[model samples]
Every structure is written in structure tokens, then in C-alpha cells.
Target: MNKQKYWLPVLGIFVALIGCITINTPIKAADTIHENYVQKIKAKKELVMGTSPDFPPYEFVKNIHGKSTVVGLDVEVGQEIASDLGVKLVVERMDFDSLLVALETGKVDMVISGMNNTPQRAKSVSFSKNYYQSGQDLLIRQADIHRYHNYRSLSNRTIGAQTGSIQYSLVKQQAKKAKLKGMDKDNDLILALQTHKIDALAVDTATAKAFIQNTNGLIRIPSGFKTSSAGSAVAFPKGANSLVQVANQSITKIRKNDLINKVYLPKVSKYMTNHKSKKDRQKANSMWAYKDFFLAGIGYTLMISALSVCLGLLLGIFLSLMRLSKNSWAKKIAGAYIEFVRGTPLMVQLLFIYFGLGIVVNIPALLSGIIAVSLNSAAYVAEVIRSGINSINVGQKEAARSLGMSRQLTMRYVIFPQAIQNIWPALGNEFISLIKESSIVSVIGVKDLIYQSRLVQADTYRGVMPLVITMILYFIITFSLSRSMKYFERKMGHSND
Candidate 1:
């Protein structure tokens, strides 16, 4: 009958079904299934880069138009990589030693601070293709040039190198009988030589050259000393293969397009000239010129101290209550925690939080600082509160109970207020102490007052002025807090009268 027409309609339906199947299938199945690091970066529309911007030519901060900004070859390369990925670039400045930890904790998408691919670092993070090669150089005081002019001459001399850098390893292995001291930044190493803290510093030739050229009283030991070559590369979190591939492509493109030569070199030359010139030293050396940086540091230091102390107070109250609890287990647990925290130095706690617990917890530096400092402060505060509570006369509790107050009500209404009044001075001292202790968080790159002082010291290469300014700021803050606290104590005393 209509067999041909019926078959034709069925054939048309079959073709339509096949076309729909093809359309539904992803053209790149691997990309969708893997959803690798590069895709995640694109989805976020921002590539977070971690850097320690104290290395000149590779990365360093410059005050441009009255704003501190990081600029150098590495920064320019980071821009290119972000451009290639069609995403915005966000640079996070931290201590060089902390950069790897930051990357592993997912705090940053990439690291481009002139990092060299060392075997130890390679084990944790994958690196892109090498973008620049530099040789290790020894920097000594100009007067000591004849003293440490060669590797053999450097024997038994104290040597400095940037911590977690290829130069650090180079100093350890190559220099004979030299005491190896690891600094946290290129600026630190330079400043060490300037301050006579270390006899010499091992740094990349380019960086050493920049430092020697710009600063007075430093000399570069002539070449012919055998040292391993260092190649700078972009680092990605381990297993970030897609990101590594994209980064490599960008590095290759940058090289082929001569971006480093045309753009980066010219910028480097300009930066070197401006930064190295004798006239710029006055500005670099002056504390007044760096007022904004110090102020920002002061603000951060105050904020962190205030927040940490508040959190500590809350936790301390809970801990004090736990210590006073009828439950033996609660008291024991509280006692152990207090001993463990109070027995250890705040620096150890900070390092543990940033390097050890950070692996599992994954928090920002500011949050980590708050937690570590608060936790430490809580231990002391708990003891203070416990003592204050016990110091109250037993007759007071008896009086409250005689009035038919419940145990909870007696503690809350009568005991706590008196305890606080007695401990207010101690608590005020703690608050002031925390402000100074907050400086410890700088090792983790929290950018507080002390950290800012270090940054300024690094930039200016004059240690005294920056530290003097920081000291003055600290005194002002602590003195103000102290005076205010005394005023409060007087007011409370008046009220009692």
C-alpha cells in the first residue's frame, strides 16, 4: 500500500534523532569531564597570584602616583598569563617563604615571584617553562670585597640567602665552612649585608647587580665562582596540569613575541634608573615619605589586635567557666588546653597555624592570625579570669545565696561583675600586650605594623629610621590605650565610692 511513504517518514525521524545525539555530545569530552584548574580559574574570572614583591627586576613594590603597587618582570608575565586566560589578575603579596604554602592551601591560583624550580619545591608544586635564567652571585661589603672576593675567600664567613630560594641551597652546598643564614626576602639579604648582620649574601646575579648598583657600600664578587644557575618559572598547585599547560603556552608566546625584551627590559631599565639613582635615596631613606605605608600598617595592626583580643575575651570566659565546672573532664580538658597554649611561644603557635594546620584548615592569613593569637590569648585570659573569680570574698557568694539566688544567678549577677572589675587592669594590659604581640603575625605575612616596618626597611635599606617610626607608632598606641584604661579604672573607682 503506502510502504514507500511510511519508510520515508521513519527514515526522516531516524536522521533527526541521530542529529540530536551528535549535538548533545560535547566536542571536547575530556575538558568537561576533568574540569581542570584552568577551567576553574576561568569560571571565577580571576587568577589569584601569590608573590613576594621585594625582588627587583623580577618583582618589587613602587610608589606610583602615591599608591604602592608591585611591578617587575614577573608581574608583567603574570599579566600576560591572565590575559591569555581571559581573566583578571589579582596579586597577593606575602613573605617569599610562605608563597608555596599559600599556593598549596588554595589561597592563590599561581605563584610568579621569580620562583626557581628546585627539586624540593618541585615535589610540592608543578612549575611552568623557565622564563629567565640567572646565576648565583655573592654580595659583600665594599670594604670586604678583598676579603670575600671568591668562594675560597668566603670560607668561614657568614653567608646570607633568601629563605626557600635556590640561592639558599646554593649557599649551603657550595660555600665552604660558611655559616648559612636564610633571610625571607632579597631585600632582607641585601639589608643584612648593609647592616653587617651577615658577611655576604648569595642572590641571583640580576638581583645582586641591582642591589649593588643602587645601594652604596656593597660590592659584587667578580664572576668565575662556580655556582648553580637559577631559572625562574611560574608555579601551580600540584596536579594542576591544565594550568601548567596554559602557563607554558603563555610563557612561550611571551618569549616568541619578544615581550620580555621589548616591554619588560625597558620597564626594568626605567625602574633600575629611578630606584638606583642617588637622588632617589633621600625619598627612599626618609620616614615621612613612607607615612602612608606605616599608617596602613598601624591600621592593620590595631584592627587585628582589637579583634583578636575580643575573641580571646569571649573564649577566655568560656574556658574559665569550664575550668570552674563541676565536671572533672571539663576541668581537665580546659586545664590541658591552657597549659599547652600558654607553655608554647606565640611564634610557634603562629607557625603551626600557618604551616601545619593551614594544610587542613585552609584559612586566610588574617583569619589565621586572629585564631592563633586569640587562642593563645585565651589561655592567659582564662587564668586571669579564674584568679579574679576566686579572689572574690566567699562571703559575697554566701550573701547572694542567702538572698535565694540560684547558683547560676549568683555567678552571673554577683560574681562575674566583681571579677571583671578586679581584672580590668590586667585585661587592659593584655589588650595592650596583644597589640605588640600582633607583630609576630608578620612572619606569616599579615601586613601589620611590624611587617610594614620590615617592608620599609627593605625598601629603604636603612633599618633605623623605619624601626624608629614603627616604635613611635607603637608607643603612641600603647600609651593611649594605657591612659584610657587608667581613666576607666578611675571612673569605676568613683562609681564604687
Candidate 2:
């Protein structure tokens, strides 16, 4: 009877505690679940906006006081939004196609590029009210303006549009009779049109006008295609209702004040006009004027390559040792990793590291690029190392063991040195490849040669010259690296002799 009384009270207390938790837990969770996207921004005191700087008038690089700054209509919109939210605006430059991904991955709080709210994109992200509505236009060579009047006029000719853009889909769906060519950047499409590769380049009215004004030998025409109301809006991650609300308020204020039409557009036009003046245009178009851009690009490219090579070498050694180990698990793991990394494309890997992994932890773009490059280089270097080690006669290891050297000592003192000597040339080739391939990091806005060249192209509106300069710079870097590698190979050869 006494035991029953004690146990009954204890059981009752336990039940009471459980009931309390069940009742209060949901309330606490609900409280915590209150949307705080705006709060987070306020706490951080900065609104990070992602954009592609190549699209002039919307977002483009400008050389102000010897500093390359991202300035345009989209930037002004982002600034307005940030100002309303009581935070500073921070811009993250990336490829236009990458802007949405960056927003989805939390790399940026919102994407304010010239992004239109389409049914397809709306499904993936929440967009604020339309800030700017622009009509579609076709840019053609000055001489071909009469040749192409509208989308229908280019029936059999090739029309170029930016890949992943609304214009790209517009051309595909409406101008079905025309051959559709897609490039990543509008500048490239303009170059294609100038070179006669594409007859017309479909772009926004503002972008087409900006290009025609700044770029020589290009003229704009109306793209008379039936389309729904398409307007640029700020994009936020899905279910970011709080952010969308604030962005809408800011956009509403902007429209109410006629800021976009009267202020922003005029300012953007002034920037474009300043670049188009005869003296300034001549100065800006000169390759020598962009020496700093190229030099900066080379510096960043070398930094990334050098760091990646060193880190990859260390990681490759570890992975190679693991693959060559006696333990089955280690060998299997190392083998699987090498195979997986080697099998995938480097661009995919770079995106994965930057955006995919970014969800778990925020990583800066440059660091992400270096990490991706190093991990990729490790896989290739691992293979080269394994081959070098395997090619060394079994006699060397056996002889080292006979001399009372432990297995680890044999690898450290005898096996590795000879393997490195044998692998020097292969390693040199890998190093050279690293230098060339590091250019891919520019896609993430790493400020490498390619990214800098794109900035120069945007700033100068002279696409081919920047490309030519970049190509020459890359050649110089690689040729120097190759010669240095050869000199080292010769020295190593002498040592072996």
C-alpha cells in the first residue's frame, strides 16, 4: 500500500511535466518561428544584393577614382530597399545566371539584377513589386538595321540572346523560325552580331539602347513579339515574405516618387553618355588605359594558382598515401573521392562549393573558388603521385626495409624522394594546368583575369580588345610558368645525374 502511494505520486508528477512540455513547446516554437528575414538584415545592418555587372544601365562596373565600382539602376533599387530597411547596401557581383542561385543558397539576401518575375522564376523565389518594366528590342549591326526590322524579319538568320534570360526564351518561342544562339554575356552576343555570327541580338530596351549608344556599329530595333507584362523585380528566397513586403514598400515608394524614370534612368544615361564622348571613349577604349585591370587580374590569377597548387600538393600526398595504404577502408574512401571529384566538371564543383555548401556555412566567393580548385587539383595530383610511386621498382622499398628502415621511414626517406623526381615533369604539367584552369574561378566573381576582362569590356564597351588583351596576358603567364618548370626539370635532372 505504501509503495503504491509513492509510485502513484511519482507517475502523476511525470505526467504533469509531460503535459506542461506539450503545451508550452508549441508556443515557444511558434514564437521562434516568427519570420525574421527583415530582422536579420537589420541586425546585420547591411542588405547584400547580388547582381551581374555586365548588363549596362541595369548593373555595370564603373571606374571611379581608380576604383571599379558596381553602379547602375539595379544598384540604385537595392540602395533604396536597403535605405527603407535602415541598412547599408552591399553589392555582390556574379554572373546573371548565378544571381538567383546565390540568393537561394544564402550567398546574398536578395538578387536585384535585371531579373524579371516570370511564372517559372516565381515558383522558385519571391519577387517584390515590379520596379522597372522594359520592352524587348533587337540589336543588329548598323549596316543591317534595314535588313532586320523585327523578330519576324530574322526568320532564317541567327539571333543571339543571353542564355538563361527571358529574351533567350522569347527568341526560342516567338522567333522559332530564326536560329537561336545563346551566349552567357550580352557583350559576347554583341560581338557575335558584329562579327556576322548572329544577325540580331535580343535584349531589353534599356540594355539595347545603352549598347547602341556606347558601342560602335550597333543599332537597336523593336522586337515585335507578343509577350506578357514582363518587368524587373527584386528576388528573394522562397517564403521570404518579410523581405518581400519590405522590398515592395521600397519599390512602391520608388514608383510613387517616379525615381526610376526621372532619377535613376537619367543618372544611368549620364554615365553612358560620359563613356561615349569622343575623348573619353578614345581614352577608355585603349588597352593601355586598362593596364591596371589586366595587372590586377594577373595578380589574382597567380595568387589563386599558387595557393591552390601548394594546398593541392599537400592534400594529394595525403590522398595518395591513403590510396596506397594497406587498410581497405582508407583505400576505398580515397579511391571513391578521387573518382567522384575527377568525374565531375570543375565548373559544377566550383558552383557546388560556393553555393551548395554555402547553405550550411557562408563562404566568400574567392575562398570558395580556391577550395574548389584545390580539391579538384588534389584528385589529379593524387593520380600522378600514385603512378610515380608505383613505377618505382619494388626493389627500392625492399632494400630500404632490409637496411632496417621502417615502412614509414622507407616511404619518407627512400620512396617519396625518388617518386617526386620521377613525377617532376608530370607535376609541372599539373601546375601549368592549374594556372590556366584557375581562370574558371572568374565565374564566381573571383576578380581573376577573365572576370577583370569582363569588367573592362563592360566599362569600355570594347569587347574584342579586352578579350585580346586577356588572351595575351594569359599566354604570358602560362609561358613564363612553363619556362620556369622546364628550368626546374633541368635542375632536378642534373641532381639525378
Candidate 3:
């Protein structure tokens, strides 16, 4: 046989064998049925609803059965929807802005936090049929009611709103001449109004009424601003038509049955008439009443900060070594990681980890917070370690090498000890900074100091006092840590002496 012909036949046979050999790897079924959000709710036996619970009568934390659980009209509405779907309801309390992200990332199936559908928000998520409609009102100090009673009078005055809220937009567009300050929580907005950081606040009529009823020295000027009527709806991820359909049906049923009037409005009225009396305000401001809430919050904040520092130190050491490596890939990878983490805002990272990464893997809020914070802290910590190592005289390393010490041993004993001593102050500062910044994790629903304080504010309907206490707690913590760092520095200096 000719050599070429024989080789061609043999090659064909090999190819045929390769085609015939089947690899029996199991690919998951498309499972479109299981993947539908409604189906997922059925399979999981619970519907996760996200809300910022600081808004009263819509969603807020209240002491329930001796435990702090989210409550209010929106929560009740969520319960109704869950019941209609024959699934349990779980409320995930987060910041107002985080609700949409949570829905987009599947952290929650729906956002029912009395959220208004605006053009900008509609681009990112779909809204259910309107469940309720609310008009905008200006909440001002009773003294300023005469001054800021009308839209024209709002000029140049600083007005407040919850960040990313419809009220914020109303203030910006309708009160365009006025300066608008957006805060993260209604409690904060109330505090700002009281502190005179803002002269007026644009809030929904119901919310404004609620605030005015409990809060002294504040009144809602009903005739001031004519903000276009806004409707509250449940938001779902884009393309979640099935979820949208069912949610809309529920909303229709709710409205058709007058549930909002019969159930929701009555609840609001109950709380509306339930404002704290003068005696209650005095008690609410008393430290003894809310000390436990603040203390628990401080404890969680400290734990998160401590763990984040330790994790950061360990990971930072590795990253520093990687960056210092002679290998090109290691240097590039470590450098890129450090820059990326340092470049992005920590809040964005926290959202990505808790909701975005959460799509692939389920992580507890506390663990997710620690991991996100540690990763962020690690980048700075690595830089600190690297700088400390570089500050050590090269001669010391060379002398250690000349004394027959291995590079690893010299780094372990002589270099690291000295670098730690040199960077002790910086490390302490990082820890202290983390203590303060840990409040950001509250957006992910971690009940840290700020979260606890917000809860106290809601419980008491007095924002300034709780915040003042929180500020003092933070000051005390940071001051004590600052002093400890100074002591450590002095001890290190004396030892060197």
C-alpha cells in the first residue's frame, strides 16, 4: 500500500474513534421552570422582600415580642403577597438605595419599601402596578412654616431628603433654586432638619404627617409644594415578567379589596395617633432606655473591625510578598488587585459582594461584610507593610545575609519584627479607621452601631439624641484606641532605646 494512503486511513480511523467516545458529564437541565422567580419562591418556601425600615408606617423596625423585627404597612403588604403566593415572607432591611440592587442581584425577589417609580429607576428595574399613591409635602420647623410655606419661598434654602428617594428628586426639580441635601435614612433627615443642616425637608404626605405627629417643633406645611403625584410599587429585576405579573395581580387584589384603606391606613392612623408624649421624649433621650441597643451595636462594630483587621493583616502580608516577588505575573496580579480595591468605593464593593457575588454563593450578611471590608482593608494594609519593609535599611538585610541567615529566616525574624514596630502606628490607625467606616456595612443590614442607633431613633421618634449618643460612643471608642496606640508606640520606642 502507498504510504500516504495508509496514513490517511489511519488518521480518519483515529478521528472516528475520538468522535465515538462519549464523555458522560452531567450538564444541568435548563430548568426554566425552577428558575422562574415565582417558582423559586415556591421551591424555597419563602419570598425575600427588601426594604429600608427607617420609614415609618411604610417600613420600620419596632420592638416585637421582645425582639427587634421590621414592621409597618409595607411589611404587612409583603405578608399579603407572600400569602397569596403561598410562601413565607422574609424581610431584608437595607438602605433605600440598596433595594433595587438587591432585586437586580436576586438578593431579594421584590422591593416593597414604599419605593416610587421614576424614569431613572425604571431603566434598571420593572415596577409592579401602583399599590398606593402619595403626594409630596414640605416638613419644616414650626417656626419656619410661614417662611417656607410655598415653593417660591424655598429659594436658596437647604432642603433635605432621603438619598435616592422620590423626595430627593422632588426637591431638586421642583425646588430647583433650593439647595438639596440627601441623607441615607429618614431618621438622619429628621435629625438634619432639627439641627438646621436643612431648613426644610421634602417628604411624602403620609411620612410627613407621621413625623409631624411625634416630633415637636416640626410641622408639615400642606400647601407648600406641588410635586407631581408619585405612586409606590414593588420593584423587580428587569425581564422578571412572571414575578411582575403575579405581583401586579396581588396589588390589584389588594386595592380592589380596599386593603390599603381598611388595613394599611388604619395601621398608619394607629401609629399616627401614637406619637411620643413629652414624658416619652424625655425618656427616649435618656441613655438608660437605649443603652443596650447602642452597646450591642458597638459590640458588633468592634467584632467586625477586629476580624477585618486580622484578616487584612494576613492577606496583606501575602499580597505584599507577592508584589515584592521577582516574578512578573505575581507583581502584576498583586498590583492590579491593590489598585482595583483601593480605587472603588467600599459601598460599591459591599453591594457587589453581598448581592452580586451572592448570586453565585450564599453568604451570611456578617461574613460577607467582614470579607468585603477585609479585602478593602487588605489593599491599604499591603501598601503599609510594603512601605514599612522598604523603609528598613538595605544594609541591615545585607548584614543578615552576610551572617549566613537564609532570606526567609531573616525576613521572618529581623525584617518583619522591625517592620511591624515601624508600622505599628499606621496599623493602629487603619484599625481605628475601620472602626469608623464599619458603619457602611449597615447598608447590607448588619446591626452595627449606626444600624442600632437608627433603630433607636425609629423606636423613639427622636433622631438627634440617638445620633448624639452614637457620636459619643464612637468618640470614646476611637479615643481609647488612639491612646492605646500611643502607649504601644512609646513602649516600642523605649524598647529600641
Tens digits of per-residue lDDT, candidate 1, 224-276, equal 34644448999987768888888899999988888897889688758656656
Q: TM-score for every candidate vs. truth?
A: 0.87, 0.91, 0.86
Q: Write the per-residue lDDT of candidate 2 for residues 1-497, one digit (tens) a residue.
A: 33342344345544754564355334433443328989999999999999988888999998776668999999999999999999999998888888887876678999988988899998767888999999999998889867889999988899999988899989999998999999888888888888899999999999998998788888899999767855999899787888899889999899999998899989988777776457877986687877888889899999999999999999999999999999866776677678778878999889877876665567899999899999999999999999999999999999999999999999999999999888989999999899989999988889999999998888888878888888888889889988998998889889889
Clashes of each: 0, 0, 0
Name the candidate, 1 or 2, with the larger TM-score value: 2
Best by TM-score: 2
Q: Worst 10-residue stretch by lDDT in candidate 2?
A: 1-10
Q: Model 2, clash count?
A: 0
Compared with the true structure, all predictions reach lDDT values of: 0.81, 0.86, 0.81
TM-score for candidate 2, residues paired by index: 0.91
Candidate 3 residues 9-71, lDDT tens each?
Answer: 345544643443221111112322223768878999999999998887788776544357787
Q: Which segments of candidate 2 are over 4 A away from where they belong?
A: 1-34, 275-277
Instruction: Flag the better candidate by lDDT, 1 or 2.
Output: 2
Clashing pairs in 1: none
Residue 144 deviation, candidate 2, in Å?
A: 1.8
- Model 1, C-alpha of 206: deviation from truth (Å): 0.6
